[model samples]
Target: MTEKALTIITQREDLPQLFGKRIENQAAIEEIISKIEFESRSITFDIETKDGQATCRSLAAKIASAKSALDKAGKAKKDEYTVTTKLIDADRNLAKSRLQALQDEIRQPLTELEQREAQRKAQHEANLAALGFVNIQAHDHVGSDLVKERIVFLENTVIDDSWEEYKSQALEVKDNALRILRPELERVKKREDEQAELARLRAEQAQREQQEREERIAREATAKAKADAERQAQQIAQESERKEREAKEREARLIAEKESAELRAKQQAEDAAKREREAIEAERLEAERLEAKRQANKKHRDAIFIAAKDDLVAGGVDEEVAKQVIKLIHENKISNVTIKF
Candidate 1:
């Protein structure tokens, strides 16, 4: 029997190259189990002789004989003795056949187990790839469905090795990887939803503000229109009042002009009547003064005529001549009164 490291010794050189890696590391294989710890299945090696020729007790003697033969060969090499060995020559062919069968029996289970392990590792890597997909950038959000499945798969596969110190660390690493990636991804998704909602609220607020501003503008316009209407009304009232005042002034002016004209005409008529009365009074006074002077002259003439007649009667001239002289004396009455002709 030959000896080597557990991993290298168990490998089947005759198997297909593609299938070799599957069984290479499994402890189920006889060669691989032989180099493992004391609990390994192939902890002891047994030698078998031809059937019916030797029992279990004789098998031990055969192993002893083989060991002795190998020791002789080593000593002979040192002594420079050349000895032809026949023990290996007689039984090597049969031993080779038996060893080949035993290794095949062990390798069958190892190949199945390794195939299962490879599948598990492939599934784990696929899960990792899905979780760490480049499409899911740092700021992006993705679903956790695939990642959760991967975690479940890893948990199931880790059952047998989780107790081992080295495997426990590897399991912890897997756990940590999942722990770090999952929540942050979920949080990013939540934040994205919140941002969308915030945008909606802002849009609504802007619309509301615009509506309020429009309403305010409309109210202001209405108020301005009302104020303008009020001012216009006041202006109209003032204009109407001014026109009425003008009409009243025109009426008053006409009345005053007519009254003034009537007063002037009445005063002129009164002045003309006064002037006529003064002229009449003056003429009457002049007529009375002339009549009194005429009366005094008539009385003086009557006295003088009486005196002239008396003188003519006393003188007694011839009858005819005396009569003519008396007539002359009456005509010349002033002469008898010492009148100067």
Candidate 2:
């Protein structure tokens, strides 16, 4: 019981609010309040003492228990047992409010005294905490544009007496936040560049494939024409040889010989055309093979870079900074990062 601290709640006007509203079981309410008052008398206001703190804690617990009992007996029980809702509400609200108000009156000065050092600390700490996060992380969920906007806003923020003695700490937090944020923008930019390069490669590959298709069509048409010519010349020589063996054997023999030479020329021409088509097809296949190899190597290397970047991001590095780091590592420029081929 705080005989010394109790003086703070002893104003003559305070006694009226404690017994003001007429409610059910007034006798019980009065009994609880009386018990609290008697117990509080022994709680002599020495918050600096360990026993004083324990007494204050016990007093707070008792107050809370009493408040709960009063609330349950009125606000909730009225719902279970039959009672006029309006009447119950009025009485219950008044009882609960009076109880809370009385408790506040008793605790106000004690609380103020108890939290003196903490209050002093909180006064500056609140401002320092505000300085650290002021709109810096507020725009994070919105997107990069808003985040960038917030960074600009933070940069423009005047760091002076408003931040108090925590100006340097505030500035450092802001700088660190920006350092993490700036890299995401860079990652976006670099990703776009990579996409553009991949697009160019795809376009070039399409063009080469199209050109090869057209050339293949032309080669097939040429081979067909040469085959037709060779077949016609072969048939003519066969007929000429047969006629020479039957009538005007000598003259027919020379005519057959002339046909034979023409047949030889046609066959040679057909062979040459076939060899040319094969050479062109081989050249096209070789080119395609080289491109495929190059693309595969590129894909493998890109996977490495992407994996490195993603791992960095997972480890809490900013996205753009991670991308840049991967690039530097792959290029053998960043010796500090623990990465390998």
Please name the candidate that would achieve the greatest lDDT relative to the true structure. 2
lDDT score, candidate 2: 0.71
lDDT tens readout by residue for model 1, 169-284:
45556666567656655766676678889989999999999999999999999999999999999999999999999999999999999899889888878877877787787778
Native-to-model Cα distance after best TM-score fit, residue 197 in candidate 2, in Å:
1.7
For residues 1-341, could you state the per-residue lDDT of candidate 2 as single tens digits? Answer: 34433333342233333343455847434754676677766557579999878878888876665555555545444454445767789899999999999999999998988799577668768755654553434333445565567568667767786656677877787777667657755654565677779999999999999999999988998998899889989988988888777678877788989999899999999999999999999999999999998898888878888888888899999999998887777777966665554
RMSD for all candidates, in order, please: 47.0, 53.2
Cα error, candidate 1, residue 192 (Å): 15
Would you list the clashing residue pairs of candidate 2? 1-40, 1-41, 1-42, 1-43, 2-40, 2-43, 2-44
lDDT of 1 at 278: 75
